[model samples]
Structure formats: C-alpha cells, structure tokens
Target chain A: MVEPLVELKGVSKSFGSKKILDNVDLKIYPGDALGVIGPSGTGKSTILRIIAGLLKPDAGEVYIQGQKRQGTIEEGEPSLGVGMVFQQSALFDSLTVDENIGFALYRYSKLPPKKIRELVERKLEIVGLPGTGDLYPAELSGGMRKKVSLARAIITDPNNPDNAPCMILYDEPTAGLDPIASTRIENLIHDLLFKQGLCRAYAIVTHQASTIRLTTERIIFIYQGKIQWDGKREEAYVSTHPLLKQFFSGSIEGPIP
Target chain B: MNRILSSSGLWSWIQRSWAAILLSGKAIFFLITRKLDFSSSLEQMMAVGPASLLIALVTASVIGMIFTIQVAREFLQLGAGSAVGGILAIALARELCPVMMAVVVAGRVGSAFAAEIGTMKVTEQIDALYMLNTDPIEYLVIPRLVACCIMVPALSILALFTGLTGGLIVAQMYGIADTVYLDSIYNFLDVWDILSGPIKGVVFGALIAIIGCSWGLTTRGGAKGVGQSTTAAVVTSLLAIFVSDLFLSWLMFQGLGQGATMIGQ
Candidate 1:
C-alpha cells in the first residue's frame, strides 16, 4: 500500500475548559486534493494550522507521513515540506513583491538573488500573476496579494523535494474574493496542482462550493472540531450527515450556533 | 452561595491572573533560552546597522539646527550670548539628543515593529514560525532588541554631535565673543557631560523595544488592534522617555547636589 503523505490521529485541542478538537483524525494521500468545509470558526482553519505545525494539539498525535512528533519549533524541526497560504494572505506590506516572494528562499536556500528572482517570476506565472515583481502589497488588490502568497508557498516546493511537506495547506484561499475572482482562484488552484506535477495532497479549507467543487477530489466535513463526514466529493449530496445537510442548506436552524 | 462565591471565585481569578503572568514569562524565558550564538546576533547587528544609518543622520541634523537656533537666541538676549556654545553643548549633549532622537525613532521604528509583529500574531504566521521549530521571540524579538539597543544610542550620539555643531554655527555667525563662548562652553561640559547622554540612549532603546514588542505581541482586535498598538507604543515610549529623563537627570547631577556642580578642578 502507498503511504499516506499526511495523517492526523485522534488529535484534540482545548482552550481553558472548552474543547476545540476531540478525537479528530484525517489523512491525505500523495497527489490527493482534500477540501474541508464547515461553519465559520468551526476549527477548519485550526486544522490547517495544526497540520502546518502552527498550533500544538492538547492530545493525540499529528504525523507528517509516519514520523512521531518530537519537538517544539525551538528545536528547529526541519520544515515539514508543508507551506501554508494564510486566510488573510499575510503578505509583508513593507516588502515588495520580489522581496516577499523571495523571503523563505533567501533565509533557507543558498540560491543567488538572480536565481531566486527567476524562480519567483516563474512561480508567479504559474499562479497567473506574471510580471508583478516590484509592486508593494498595499498597491495590489486583495486577490493579487493572495496569489503572491501562493507563489511564495509554491516557489521553493519544487526545489526542496526531499525535506519539506509535499502537502500545502491553504486557509480559506477564496474567502473574500468576488464570484469572478473566486472562480479565477478556483481554476488557479487546479492548474497549480497539475502544472508542477506536485503531490496531490493539498488541503484547502474553504466555504465556497465553487472552490470545493473545482479544487478538491474529496471533501471532509468538519463541525465543532470533529470530522463529521468524509467521502468523495461526489458523495456529498447523498450523504445524510445532518451537519452537511444543515451547512449545505445555509440555514439558521442548524447544529452550528 | 455567598460562601462558595467568596473563596473559589476569588481564588480562581487569582489563579487565572497568575497563569497569564506565567504564560507571558514563559514566552520571554523560552525566547531567551533559544538564543542563537553570539556570532549570529553579531551578524544581525551588522545587517541592521548601516540600513538604519541614514534616518539617524537626517533626524540628528535637524534636531541640532533647531536646538542651536533657540539656544543662541536666549543667551544673546541676556548678554550671555557668547556662552551659547557652552549651553548648547550641555543641553544638546546631555538631554535633547537622547530625548529628541528617542521620540523620533520611537515614532519611526517602534511603530513598524508593533505593526509587523501584530500582523504576524493575528495571522498565525508567528505560530507557523513556532511549528517550523523557530522560536518567534528568538527569530523576531532578539534581533529587534539587539538592533534597537545598538541603534538608538548610535542615533543619540549623532544628534548630540550635530546639535552642538549647530550651536557653534549660530555663535560664530551671530558674532558672539570667542572668549566668553569658549569659557562658557568649557565651564559647562566635560567628559562626564557627554557621558550622560549616551547613557540615556541605552535606556531609551530598552524602553522602545519593551513597549513596542509587548504591545505588538498582545494585539488581538485585528487591524484595529494593530493600529491601536502602534499608537500605544509611540505614546507610551515617548512618555516613558520623558519621565525617565527627569529621574535620570536628578540622580546624575541635581539629586547628588543642589544642581549642576563643579567637577574635579
């Protein structure tokens, strides 16, 4: 059997007396696209962060492939090959497009600036944002910033094949875009998956059906931090999971409150 | 009901407060523990150095000009004009340099620190740093603290030098008597005079870093929180500088004596 690229086993997290995640488990196989959907603040983004090693779980284990977690970030844990594009796009405003895109490379890679620039430009083109190198983040539109961030995430992935997580986690990749822009982004997400011959194990946490339908091969319904339903995207409508029914209908009387 | 509320309720609140303090302490302690080798800190210092030089130069020059113009006017009107150079040296070297530079830099660099860190905190980029086995404080705060501690004083020294030169230009251009000018100047400042200013610079740097980083780390209200923290860092740092300046001045000279006094003669 092929090894799963990323897996979460019985993971749980809590703040004070409130439990956010309980006995949650998930897996993404190499070259598989996973979409996580649920109500706002349902810990969908939290899961993405956990996978990225951003948040520590209170119980259970998170394994990147099969490695047992051993240390905090202070330990300089090797970059788990997982790159994340944040919900806010979190691009550095002080940095220009070239600098922002080249940030991680400059820090971690010994590549010359010219090489990094070339790589950055190519990554931007892959994300449908060509020739936007000198612009500061504030000058660009929100959608453009998100694309730059995506380019930043993907640029080094092709180079660091051995060390980094092949699975990328996108936190609400299309959250604030207009319908047209969202569709554009949705298409970009698909194109990126196939373009680089990257592993298919990306987990995109989003609320838009258009994005989910376009980008994911499988959909995992997360509600109140536990996995409520897991199946192929085509099985979404037929599945009688009450949470999905309530969430898909976009109703007021649901388990979400 | 009253009995239950009296003990456990108060006790719980105390425990919560203690926990919060401990958590913040852990953040600081952990950052301190994970510090890179001195050579790495040295490298960061080297990088942050020349990048910040130009701003310090421009600000110090302007401050010098203003300080000289006003000081020359006061001494001139009082028939002590020739003494303008000495007064300028004493005031600019001892107080104005550190104070003005602190306020200027606190406005420029301090706000930038708060905004950058605050965004990282909100977006979980900081947490991302943690996951990658990077201590956010070690990766972020140490370099900032080291850089600012080095730069703030560096800027202050420049300001004092320029302000005193500015006074010299005023005295010479205005035709103050060279005899009184030199006498008053020599009478006022000595090696110890200049010594006090750089000391203030060190304190100012610490104040700016502590307030800016603390506010940035605690930011929670999203964009508004980042903005508010930026504003708070500048206001609190500048105010703290003024208050501390007074206390430092008192302890250095006036508190030890009635006022400024004779040095070893």
Candidate 2:
C-alpha cells in the first residue's frame, strides 16, 4: 500500500452555528494530485487550511504523513510541512520578488548569501520568471503575480533536501486567470506534480471544471459541509448522484440548499 | 426601527473595533519575535528616518521662532525682553520640542507604516508567511518597531536643537540683547525637561508602533479595511499622545516641584 501523505478522520468545523465542514474523512496518497471541487462556501478551502494546520477542526484527527498535527496553528506555529497558495495572489507588495521568494529560505538554511541568491534565482527560473527579482508585487500582472507566488511556495521544494511529505495546497490557483493563462497555470501544476512523481503529493481547492480535468487524478466534491462524491476526476461529471448532477449542472436550485 | 437600527449598527462597529484591537494585540506579541525580514526592517528605517529629517527641521524652526516672538513681545513691553533667551528655553525644553516632533512623526511616518502593513495583510501576504513557516510578527513587527524607536528620539533631538536656534534668531532680531540669551535659556531648560520629553518620546514611539502594526495585522474587509486601519492608527496614536501628555506633564511638574521644595526646605 502506498503511504498516505495526508489523512483526515472524522474532521468537522463550524463558524458560529454555520457548519463549514462535517466529518470530513479523506486520504491523499503520496504523489497523487487530488482535486477538491465544490461550490463557493462548501468548505473546500477550509479543508486545505485544516490539512495545512492553519485552522483546527472542531472534532476529528488530522495526520500529516500519518502524524497528527493540530493545536500548533492556534499557538502560531504551522506543524504540517504544507505550503499554500491562497485564492488571491497573496504576494507581499512591500517586498520585492526576490525578497518574497527568499522568505522561505531565510530561516532554517545554513547557506551563505551568495549561495542563497543562486538558489532563489533557480526557483524563479523554474517558474519562467528569470532575472526579475527587484520587481514588487504591484508591478507584476495578475497571472505573473500568481506564478511568482507559486515560485515562492515551492521555494524550498522539500524533495530537494529531504523527502518531507511535501504537499502544495493550492486555493483557486487559476481562478482569476484568462483562459490561456489558466491553461498555462494548469499545465505548470501537472508538470510540478509530475516532478514530484512518487515523492510529493498535491491538493487543490477550486471551482473551475477545466482545472479539475487537467491536473487532478482523484476528485472529491464538497456540498453543505460534507463530501458529496469521491472518485476519479473523469467520473465526477458523469456521476448520477443528485448532488453531483446539481453541482455539475450549474443549477441555481440544487441539492446544495 | 430606524433609530434602533442605527444605534445597533454604531454599537457593533465600536465592538468590532475593540475586538480587532484585542485580537491584534495577541498577533503583535507573536510578530515581534524576530520572524520579519531583517533587511526590510533596516531598509524601512533608513527610508523613513532619512526622509523625515527635513520635516522635523522645518517644524522645529517654526516652533522656535513662534516661542521667541511670543516671549520677546511680552518681555519687550514689560522691559523684561532681555529675558527672551530664558523664555525660549523654558518653552522648548519643557513642552514644545519633543511633543511637536513626535506628533509630526506619528502623523506622517506612523500612518504610512499602518497603511503599508494593513494592505499587505488584507491581500493575504501574511497568510503566505505562515505557509512558509515564517512568523509574521518576527518578519513584519520587529523591524518596524525598532525603526520607529530609533528614529523618534533621533528626530526629537534634532528638533530640540533647531528649535533653540530658531528662538535665538528671533531674540537677536528683537534686540533683547541686554541679558545673556544663550546662557539664560540653557539655565532655564533643566535636565528634567530635556530628559522627560525624550522618555515620553520613547514611550510614544512604542505606542505608535504597537497601534499601527496591530491595526494592520487585524485588518479585514479588504482595501476599505486597510484604509480604515490606517486612519484609525494615526487618529488613535495622536489621541494617545495628547491624553498621555497631560499625565506626563503633571508628573514632570510635580516631580520638579518636590525636588525644588526639598532644596528650599
């Protein structure tokens, strides 16, 4: 059996009386690019936050590489070795592109400044942004900012130094991009994950159907705080379940309410 | 119904502001732990401090001239215009110099810090920091706090000297040449007056930094939220300085009185 890179058992979350996630049980195998699809506010992002240990579940256990990770986030420490790219390109406007990417390696690295600069350059080059370090977030176009943010996320590439159960938790990575940009981003996602091959895993939270088709091998659809369907991505659209039909149908009135 | 709704809406806004402050306090405490970009902090200080010098100089000069004019006018009419030097020293040392300098900084640079940080926060860059295993406070708060602390006092000292110089020119212009202006001014402006204001400045810098950074970290609701926090930081820090000024003034006065009275007794 392939080692589960991440596991959630009976996880539940609520904001006031509104339940966001309900008994979410999931497992991501090593190197699997799992796509989580759902309508807005269906707790897709909440699950990502849970897996990254950013938000604690009201009940249930969360395991990263099968080790429980919780309580540390509330205390201002992210225990899971998960990197996240938020729905919005959350790059720091104040810091230049080089500084932004360099943040990940600023600590916990013994490399000298000259060496670190080389490493940072390599990370940017991998993202197709070569020799544009001094530029601020404001200078970049939307798609460019998203790519810079992606470069920042994989700055360390845990597989490079240690196989640390690394997972890139992408939140709407291609949501705001144009079709061409979206396709490019989607391809990058697959290429990066393929590079992970049998070493790193990935989880994406998004609403775009095309993004779902291109990258994710496995799929889970969330609705009303629970998993409505879980299977291969190709099977999701054809699933006869009422929830999947209503969601994929883009109906105004669906099983969601 | 309208009146009730308006009152409730006002009440929640106030409540939300208070909660944001409290929540940001915890975040600030976490942020000051050395997680922020050190190079950025150094660069920020260099940027903010060097740029503010001209403003401080202008403010100091104007305040000095005004103090000298007021004192010299009153003294000239009373045949005590010879004491213009003493009057300027008393005014600049006791109250005007440090207070004015710090207020200017709080208004100009402090607001800038709050707006910059608040916008970054609303955009989710700080969330990115967490994802990267970097503590936002260490990365964001410390450098800013350190910069403000160093810059406020440095500017205050510059303000003090330039302010005294401004008074000297005014005194010389008014022909209050009988008394030794420089010597008298120096004598009247005591150690307490000089020391107390800077001490207040150190405290004021801390207040400005905490309020600004806290507001930034706790900002929500997007761009409008950033604007709101920036405005709140400037308003609150200035208000804090003024309100605390009363107590600080009283403490300095009372402390001086006791020391003088003891000597007389």
Candidate 3:
C-alpha cells in the first residue's frame, strides 16, 4: 500500500468562540489532486494552513510523510517541503518579481545572486510571465500577480532537493479571477502537476465550479466544521448528499444553512 | 467600567505587548549571535538616519533658539550673561535632544514601521515569510531595531551640535560674545553630560523600534487595524520614551554632584 504524503488525524481548530474544524481526519496521497470546497467561513483555508504547518491544530496529529509533526513550521523544518499559494498572492510589494520569486533562494541557498536570478527567470518563464523580473507586484494585473505568486511557490534550491516542495496547498487560487483568467490558472496548475511534475500532491481550496471540475481528481465537501461528503470528482455532481446537492445547485433549501 | 476593563481591546493590547517583548528578546539574541541581514539593516539605516536628519536638525535648532530666548534675557539681567551657553548645553544634552529626537522618530519612522508591517501582516506576507523559511523577527524587526539603535544616537549627537550652534548664534545676537558662550560651555559641561544624550537615544530607539514592530506583527483586521496599529505604535513609543526617560535621567544624573560643583567655580 502507498503511504499517504500528508495526513491530519482528528485535527480541530477554533477561533475565539467560533469553532472552525472539529475532529477532521484527512489524507492526501502522492499524485492526488484534491479540491476542498465549502461555503465561506467553513475553514477550508484553515485546513490548508494546518496542512502547510503554518497553523497548528488545537487538537490532533499531523503526519508529514509518516513523521509526526512536532510543532509549527517555525520550530523546525517539516519532513517534506510544503508550499502554499495564498489567496491574496501575498508578494512583497517592495521587491521586484524576480526577488519575490527567488526570496527563499536568496536568503537560504548557497547559490550566488546571478544563479538565483537565472532560476527566478526560469520559473517566471514556466509561469508564462517571462521578462517580468523587474516589475513590482503593484505594476502587474491581478491574474499576473497570481501567476507571479505561483512562480514563487514553485521556486526551489537547485542544489538542495530536500528543500523542494513535495506538496503544494493553494488557498483560493482561482477566486476573484475572471473566467478566462481562471482557465489560465487552472491550465497552469494542471501543467505544473501533470507535465512539469513540480509536486507529488496538491490541494486547492476554491469556490469556482470550473476550477473544481478541471483541476481536482477528488473532492471533499465541508459544512459546519465537519466534512459533509468525500468522493471522486465525477461522483460529486450526482451525489445525493443533501449539503452537496444544495451547494452544487445553489439552492437555499437544504441542510447547508 | 469593569466591562470596559475586560474588553477585548485591553486583552489585545496585553497580547501585543507580550508579543513585542518576545520579539525584542529574540531580536537581541539574533543580534548577539551576529545573525542579521546587513543589506536590510543598511537600507533601514538610510530611512532612520539620513532621511530623518533634516527634521531632527530643524527641531533641534528651533528648540535651541527658543531655550536661548527664554534664558538669555533672565541670565543677563542677573549679571550672569556667560551662564546661558552652559545651561543650554546641559539641558540639550541631558533631556531635550534625546527626547525630542526620539519623539520625532517615533512619529516619523516608528509609525511607518507599524503601518508597513501591519499591512504585510494583514495581507499574509508575514506568513509567506514563514513559508519561505525566513524568520520575520530576524528579517524585519532586527534591521529596524539596529537602524534605530545606531541612527538615533548618531542623530542625537548631530542634533546636539546643531542645537549648540543655534544657541551660539542666538547668544551672539543677544550681545553675549561668542567667546563668553564658548568659555562657559568649556567650564561647565562635562564629558558625561555630552555622552548622556546618545546613551538615552540608544534606549529610546530600541523602545520605538520594538514597540512599533511588535504592534505591527500583532495587528489584526484589515485597513482599520493597520491604522490603529500605526496610531497605537506611535502613542506607545512616545509613552515608553517618556517613562524610560524618567528612569534614565535618574540613573545618569541622580544628584547634581559635578554640574553644581562646576557652577560653584
């Protein structure tokens, strides 16, 4: 049996008096493309953050490549590199595109600036934003900024394969984008996963129907701090799960509320 | 009133204060270990030092002129015209220059640090920094702390000289010859008095940077949060400076041992 790349067992998180996740067990295997879909404020993003080791669960264990995570990312390095693409792109406004993409390399890698720049340019080319190394985040369009952030997520140290991301978690990667822009991002995500083999596993948290249909092979529907339904992508549309039906049909007449 | 005291606002402030203290401790540790980004520190120095020089000098000059105006007439009427320069120098070195420069920087640079970092916090750039395997304290707070620590003192020294020059010019205008003013300063001002300004500046700079950066890192909400953090950071820095100044003043000049004896001469 293939081991799961990442697993969250009985993970729970809360904010103040509001509980976001409750004893949620989730697992992602190598080559898995999972979509986590739910209504707003349902803790999809929180799950991604927990998986990336950016946020610790109030209760439970997170196993990264079979190693029980000890603490938050600040405490120690994870067994595998987990890259996260934020909903807001989160690029440093003061740095150029190249600098934003090559931030980790410039800070931690033994490579020279010239080599880092070359790698940054190569990542930019992969993200289809070539020759944009000199431009700031403010100068780019919203979609371009998203692409730039994608490029940043995929950048890795050439000499240190251990540091390369084995799993990528994208939080709302296609939200706030026009359909055409969403299609481009979806295509790029597919290319990175299937053609480029950038990561062994990935998860996307998005509300976009097209993105869920196009980019994900498996789907999990969350509601009221628990997983309502879990199944393959194709079965999501036809499932009789009341919350899933209401969520897919855009109906207010169900258990979702 | 109990409800007000128990409000989340108060709790949040406590949390932020604790976070700031932790950040300051971490930054000092990194500084001791020499684990810092030199380029970032240099960039922050430019912002904290040369960029703020003009305002600091202007403030010091105006203060000097004002103090001289207030004291020269009184001193001259008492047949002690030569004491004006020494008094001005002592006042500037002991209290005025360091406090005034700190206030100026707290308003200018401290507020800016809070707003910039608060925005980054709201936008998740701080989390992104963590994702990229960068410690935000080492990358962000230490540089600002280093800049403020180094430059605030440098600015205080410069401001002290500028204030003296301003007092000298004003004294000359008041018919107390430049020679008289120079002689008085030479006789009355001790080396410790001159060194105290920069010493206080180093302490105040640390307060400003640490408070500002801590408020920023603990910022919640969005634009309104950033605005509040910026305001709170400046206000907190100002309060910290004044409170620390009281203790620093006491520690450095508790008793009038030397200055009083020099006056007896």
Candidate 4:
C-alpha cells in the first residue's frame, strides 16, 4: 500500500457548546482522489481546514507524510504540500485574474515577473480560461471566477519545486453554477488531477453526485459529526447504508433527517 | 443593579479592545523582525498620503484663514497686529494641523482600512491569506502601519506650510504689513514649535492604523459587522487622537517656557 500522505487521527472540534466534529479518522494516500460528502454544516470543510493547518483540532492529531504537523509558520515546512480552493472563489477582488493566479509565485518564488505572467497564462489556459489575465474577479462570471481561483491554487512555484502543492482540497468545487458551467469545472478538476498528473491526492467536499462520480475513486459519507459510511465510489450506489442511499437517491424520506 | 449589568458589557468591550491592542503590538513587532513588504507599504502610502493631500491642505487653509480673520482684526485694533502671525503659527503647529488633519484621515483613510479589512475578514479573504501561508499581520497590518507612520508626518508638515501660507494671505488682506506679519512669524516660530505637530502626527497616524486594522480584524457577524466596525474604528480613532493629544501636548511643551530660546531675537 502507498504510504498515506495525509492523516487525521481521532480528530474533534467544537464551537461554543456545539460539537462540530467528533473522533473522526481519515487518510489519503498518494495519487488518491477522495470525496467527502455530507449534509451542510456537518464538518466536511472543517476537516479540510484542519488538514491545511488553518485551524487546530480541539483534540487528536493531524499528520503529513507520517510526521506530526507543526504549529506556526516559523516552524519548518510540513512534509506534504496543501492547497485549498475556497467555496466562494475568495480571489482578491483588488487584484486582476493574472495577479491572483500568480500571487503565490510572486510572494514565494524567485521567478521574474515576466516568467510569472507566462506561467499564469499557462495555468489560465489549463483551466480553459485563456486570455483572462487582464480581467478582475468582479468582471468574470461566477464560473470563470471559480476556475481562476483553482488556477491560483494549483499554479506551481517553478522556482521552488518544493513549494508545489501535491494535496489539493476542493470545497464545493461546483456550487452555484449552471449545469454546463459545473460540467466545465468538473472536467477541469479531472484534467488537473489525472490528465495533467500534477496532484498526488485530492479531497473534494461537494454536493454534486456527478462531481463525485467523475472526480473521486473513494468516498466517505459524514453526518452529525461522524463518518457514517466509507467505501469506494463503486460501493456508494450498491451499499444499502440507509443514510448513504438517502443521500445518493436524493430521497427526503430516509434515515438522514 | 444597572452598574452591574453595564459593567459586564463594559468589561467585555475592554477585553476586546485590549486583545486588539495586543495584536497590533504583535504586528508591529513583526515589522522589526521580518522582511517588510515594501510594495504593499508603498501602495498604502499612496492611498494614505498623496491621495489625502488635497483634503488636508484645504482643511488647513480654511482653519488658518479663519484664525487670521478672527484674530488679526482684533489684534490690529489693539496695536498688537504683529502678534497675529506668531499666534497663528503657534496654534497651527502646536495643535490645529495635527488634530484636524488626523480627524480627516481618521474619517477617510482609517474608515477605509476598517471597511476593506472587515469585508475581507467576513468574506474569508483573510483566511485565504492564511491558507496561502501569508500572515495577515505581516502582509496586511504592518504595511498600513508603516505607511501611515511615514505619510501622516509628511502630510502634517505640508499642512503646516499650507496653513502658514493661508495665514499670510489672510493677514495681507486684513491690512497687516508683510514685514510685520513675516517678522512676527520669523521671530516667534521656534524650530521646536514647528517640530511638535509632525511629531504628534506620527503618533496619531499609528493610532489610526492600529485602531482601524484592529477593529477590522476583530469584526464578526458579516456585512453588518463590517459596517459597525468601520463606525467604531473611526470613533475610537478620533477619541484616541483627542485624548492622546492632551498628553502629547503637555509632555512636548512642558518646562519649555514659550520656546523663545530656539529663535534668538
């Protein structure tokens, strides 16, 4: 078995008196595409935040490449590279699309501005958003903004190969989009993760069944702060886990509510 | 019973403000120990400095003219017309330019910082910065802090000169002789007096930046929160300026005894 690149062991989180996550364990191996499916506010995004070190788990440990995650930016870099595609795109409104895509490069790479722009254009092309370098986020449609945001996350730091993100976390990779736009995004994710062969592992938190079917090989169903079901994508449809069936069937009358 | 109820609210507010101050201090400390983002700082300077130049100049000019109109007429009637220039210079340098310019900036630049950062906070842009391995304090707050510290002092100096020009114009129209007006300012305006306003400006600038950014970082509850933070930031910055001004004025001028020695007769 390939060594797990990222792991969450006995993880838990709470806000005020409400528990958000409880004793959750998860693992992602090299080259794995995992789908985390759940009802809204069921700690899917929270899990991604913990893995990225943006938020600390109230209990339990997060490990990257079998090493314990370190706290604080001053600590040496973690063993695994992590990138996040935010649900809202979250592209800096003040920056142009190219500037947004090239931000990490500009901040952390030694590449000249000309080279950065060239690389940004390349990423834009990869996302099927060619010639959008000059446009701002506000000028772009919702779908375009989402694609540009993904480009920003996955744009490699050519100068520092070490900074290249291998683990990508997609929060709602296709939300608030027309079906055609969502298909485009789903194709882009497929191309980036498998066709281009850039990423090692990915976890997508999304409601779209097609997105899960097309992008992920493994899936986990989370409900009420616990992993209620875990299995391969093939098993998702056949497994008669009532909650999973309810979710997959889009049926209102089931064990889910 | 009323005191008990209000004290809890007051105490929580104090704790919140204290946390913000501590965060600002940490951001400032990061300035000393880390590589400063000069590009961002320069951008903020352009926003808080030259961009604010027109309004600061206009406000100073109006205040200077008003001071001269009110005082020059009365002083000339009393045979102390020459004293009008010195008094205007003193008041503008010691108090008017710094306080008034700070008020303008608190309204404009400070509110802007709070609004921008507050929106960023609520929209998860700040969280995105963190996910990018960018420290918000280092990337955001320090640049604004450094920009305000540099720009506000520079603006205060410009405001001082503009105010003097306004006073000179008003004095000429009020029939005070140029020689009398110029001579009085030359004789009475000590280097120490002139230095005081810009010095105060540096302090005021830091207060505005810290308070604005702090309130912004502390913002919650979404769009409504951003609005509330912007209003509170401006109000807090203004109050801070006035209260600090009293202490700064007393400390800078105490035991200086008119500061006449700095300008030999």
Give lDDT: candidate 3, residue A135.
95
Q: Candidate 2's residue-wise lDDT over B50-159, tens digit each?
A: 88889889999999999888878886787766467766666676577667877888888778877887877777777777777766666666777777777777777778
lDDT of 4 by residue, B1-265 (tens): 6678577656545655796789778976898799999999999999999899999999999999999999888877877787888888899988999999899999999999999999888877887787777778888899999888888888888898899899999999989888888888877888988889889999999999998998898888888999988998898899999999999998988875663342323
Per-residue lDDT tens digits for candidate 4, residues A149-176, read 8998888876677778878899997989
Among all windows of 10 consecutive residues in model 4 chain B, the one with the lowest summed lDDT is B256-265
- Superposed by TM-score, candidate 3 places the C-alpha of residue B214 at a distance from the truth, in angstroms, of 0.3
Docking class of 4: acceptable
Candidate 4 at residue A183, lDDT? 91
- Residues A196-226, candidate 3, lDDT per residue (tens digit)? 9988889999999999988999999988889
lDDT of 2 at B92: 71
- Model 4 residue B65 lDDT score: 93
lDDT of 2 by residue, A28-114 (tens): 987788999887888999999888777888999988876778565636655566778788889877678887887666566666666
Sort by DockQ, top down from the best: 3, 2, 4, 1
What level of docking quality does candidate 3 show?
medium
Candidate 3, after superposition: displacement of residue B144 in Å? 0.6
Cα lDDT for residue B72, model 4? 88
- Indicate the TM-score of model 1: 0.78
The best candidate by TM-score is: 3
Poorly placed runs, candidate 3 (over 4 Å): A77-79, B6-8, B260-265
